[model samples]
Target: MATKEEDVKLLGFWASPFSRRVEIALKFKGVSYEYLEQDIFNKSALLLELNPVFKMVPVLVHKGKILAESLLILEYIDQTWKNNPILPQDPYEKAMARLWAKFVDEQVGPVCFKSVVKADKGIDVAIEEAQELITFLEKELSGKDFFGGKTIGFLDMVAGSMIPFCVARAWEGMGIDMIPEEKFPELNRWIKNLNDIEIVRECIPQREKQIEHMMKVAERIKLA
Candidate 1:
């Protein structure tokens, strides 16, 4: 019998954009792998053993090696498979992809989510913070179809869940407009572009499902 990592396997959660980034990267590269859905709120022994320090999803196993962190897994997937490269080839472009991907994941995404939840409580301050964080991406996306440029690339996959995916559903659930076209035209245009991509549409969780899940998350955040 083949060893556990003799073939590719991804331990992930459906609602987690981090792991979804890995899944999208794999799909882009046309790599075959097994998908294991994890209940991160209730960590499994395997997940604990595989990633004791962080105990996070998006843990990738390939050729018996365990890789943690969604961005790291994305890099590994791109390098491991040459076809349909995710990161750009140019040195500067590749660096920018990594930078923006990191920024969206670490900075922009959190603020956006918090803003959505807080906006429901009649708090406009969080919206201001969200706009401030989003302005960086708005300027960066100027005159570009994607952060990765013409085609969806590494940064696109990383920010996939946060932007159009989460923002679209979250804003609808809150019954408010966030990132209006007049204000963030580039980002809105980017959202339209992403919506037109079949694979992107397929990869994201359903809109109603995401909205329900995000509302549940909002409740938790309120308690916290």
Candidate 2:
């Protein structure tokens, strides 16, 4: 078990999945730290100073060294604490984990969720595209308990944060079943597994607040 690190501080938002994932990683490592709830809608000077490039939440400040980007921060946490290893020991598996994690961040996640969340504007991203993304996931999850196998790992922290209630319920609220249990049993099972973990559930943002925040982000996108 990792002891409390007084120097480690997290600047995060309540409804940001990226933030939630960092929190999950921190809990997994059992590294005690300060949780600074940031207003992502209104970035603070500290957040701006820490991460001027993106000015994003989920910033991990350790020993006065600031790290931004959720994936990078997760890796830092794993390397720094060296407890509850998030990555696989096998190099091949680690590479594959990284591959899918990038795919989630770049290809699959945004294309699927942005379409539904930004529905108010005339955004008509084909539902088929979203379904295709889910199909890729369903296939990848075949015969495996998780993307990183039986235990949750780096990819789990990356993709799991994005694929749960916010995306599914957001699509459902739009009268679109993005992931039907029967059609995507493996993915659904993966979701169930993630949600079943106490720490993962604890880090999850409150449902209503999350949805409200999603709508606010959509509105911001519309006006922008």
Candidate 3:
């Protein structure tokens, strides 16, 4: 449990899924904190001071100590507030969760952007890679409401950041079906399950807003 005197502050960008991951974890843990929205284009002195190396958004400041990286922030939140634990108790399961979380963070962008946005690299290759990733997740989510089985857990939160936000909106912006109902039924179901959760849904940016942003990005890529 967080002490009353311990101040928790989150420096984040509004549309960043990485930042949203930390927000979801904090909300899930029922930890009260201050949220300082940052303008990444014009970096703030506070953000630079806290995250000197990366100077990025989604910096978690707890009782004067600063933590960077979304996954690490999530872990810190879980550890700080023992209630509503996110990671699994079993060591092996925890390791698996961390592995998938890292995979989602590293791969989701390239796989999603290349598939939907016009690029020198063909969309076919990106589609194949995206399908491979989705298939793995489908198998993992088989017979489970979430990656955590009954409830949302660490992997669920991490995967949730990518799936319905960037990937889904990218496909929508392209007017093509990537995760079709017939092809990725299990994965689609899992997406719905995650979205239905109030905490996840509340923090998610509006779908229309995401689509508009993605279209602008795609246009920029084309112009470049």
CA RMSD per model (angstroms): 3.1, 2.2, 2.0
TM-score of each: 0.90, 0.92, 0.91
Stretches off by above 4 angstroms in model 1 are 1-6, 115-122
Q: In candidate 3, what are the lDDT values of residues 59-158, reduced to their tens digit? A: 9988888899999988988888899889998999999999988877777665656555764567777677677877778888889999988899998888
What's the residue-level lDDT of 168 in candidate 2?
A: 66
Pull out the clashing pairs in model 1.
none
Question: Residues 19-129, candidate 1, lDDT per residue (tens digit)?
Answer: 777887877777778899999889999999999989999899998899999999989888888888899999998998888888898788887777667666455776777
lDDT comparing candidate 1 with the true structure = 0.82
Q: Give all candidates' CA lDDT scores.
A: 0.82, 0.82, 0.83
